[model samples]
Target: METNRQDFLKKFNEAFATSDVDFILTAVSDDILWTIAGDKVIQGKDQFASSLHEMASPEPMKLKIRHLITHGKEAAVEGTMTTPNGKTYSFCDIYTFNGFKDAQIKEMKSYVVEEH
Candidate 1:
């Protein structure tokens, strides 16, 4: 199915809610730039996939989307989640999408606040 920015956000969130690595990977560009806050930044699909693989297990992280907004080819998603280690984190991700109909993510900047 062809996806616009909103559709991309929905699919991405749904995949994330279930911690579906394969499905989530399908929504990212091969050269995607993923930034965690202003500190950690990585490029390339392999690097991102590798990190996700390390995180997901039989019981994966839980994510629940509270809000999502999109304009043009950009989107911002905000949510709360529980990590595998049982830590709670509230997050917001700003995304820029490729012009393709499937709206693969070209760049993502994340901001997260965790309960210590």
Candidate 2:
């Protein structure tokens, strides 16, 4: 369980660093459910992938993980993302997972804890 959480966090952190929809989708389940702080919900892998592709940017971005905690099939993560324009946002993310032999993200909820 511990190793799984660490691996998942690594993948998730990787997802935020690039605008590659395919690489980002690799960490999620086919029926992924994602909700943003703005109350927008993206359902299913196809829809999620499409949304990401549409929002892709050529600018650089960086993600720094502050902390990650997991228990059973759930986890909470804290991090900061620095955008190309030099804006920064600190976020808290909650994730739910359920899989046959290993945990895969089935749902994710994101909240902006701070911004600058």
Candidate 3:
């Protein structure tokens, strides 16, 4: 029996494998809130889906998860991504998933930057 935190982290990684809006929708809550540094907060799953779609537009994005940490309903991920231009960016993201009972992600906040 995997904990909600573990499950969420696993599913999040799976999202990078394909642009499956359904998966994204299922993993997140109806009133999900998502944020990335310097970006406006995305208010719902619908909006999140639309935004993620653009990432896989010309080609699928690749993500490699380096580490994941979970403290109760909160979790964090450190990973590396390859941009469309072949630039690799290593990022560390901290996330909080509410509604542990539902095992659904109520909110997600991300902090990212170029690898240096």
Q: Which candidate is the best by lDDT?
A: 1
lDDT of 2 at 37: 77
The candidates, ranked best first by TM-score, are 2, 1, 3
**Candidate 2 backbone overlaps, count:** 0
Stretches of candidate 2 off by over 4 Å are: none
Against the correct fold, how does model 1 do in TM-score?
A: 0.84
Pull out the clashing pairs in model 2: none
| CA lDDT for candidate 1 | 0.82
Give per-residue lDDT, candidate 2, residue 83: 81
How many clashes (backbone N, Cα, C below 3 Å) per candidate? 0, 0, 0
lDDT of 3 by residue, 1-116 (tens): 76667666767765654566677778788788888878678888788888777655355557888788888778888888776667776776676666456677788877777765
Cα lDDT computed for each candidate against the true fold: 0.82, 0.80, 0.73
Q: What is the lDDT of candidate 3?
A: 0.73
**Alpha-carbon RMSD, candidate 2:** 2.2
lDDT per residue (tens digit) for residues 1-116 in model 1: 53366666877876775679998898899999999985688799999999777656567567788888887788899998886778888989999988746668999999989867
Superior by lDDT: candidate 1 or candidate 3: 1
What is the Cα-based lDDT of residue 40 in candidate 2?
Answer: 86
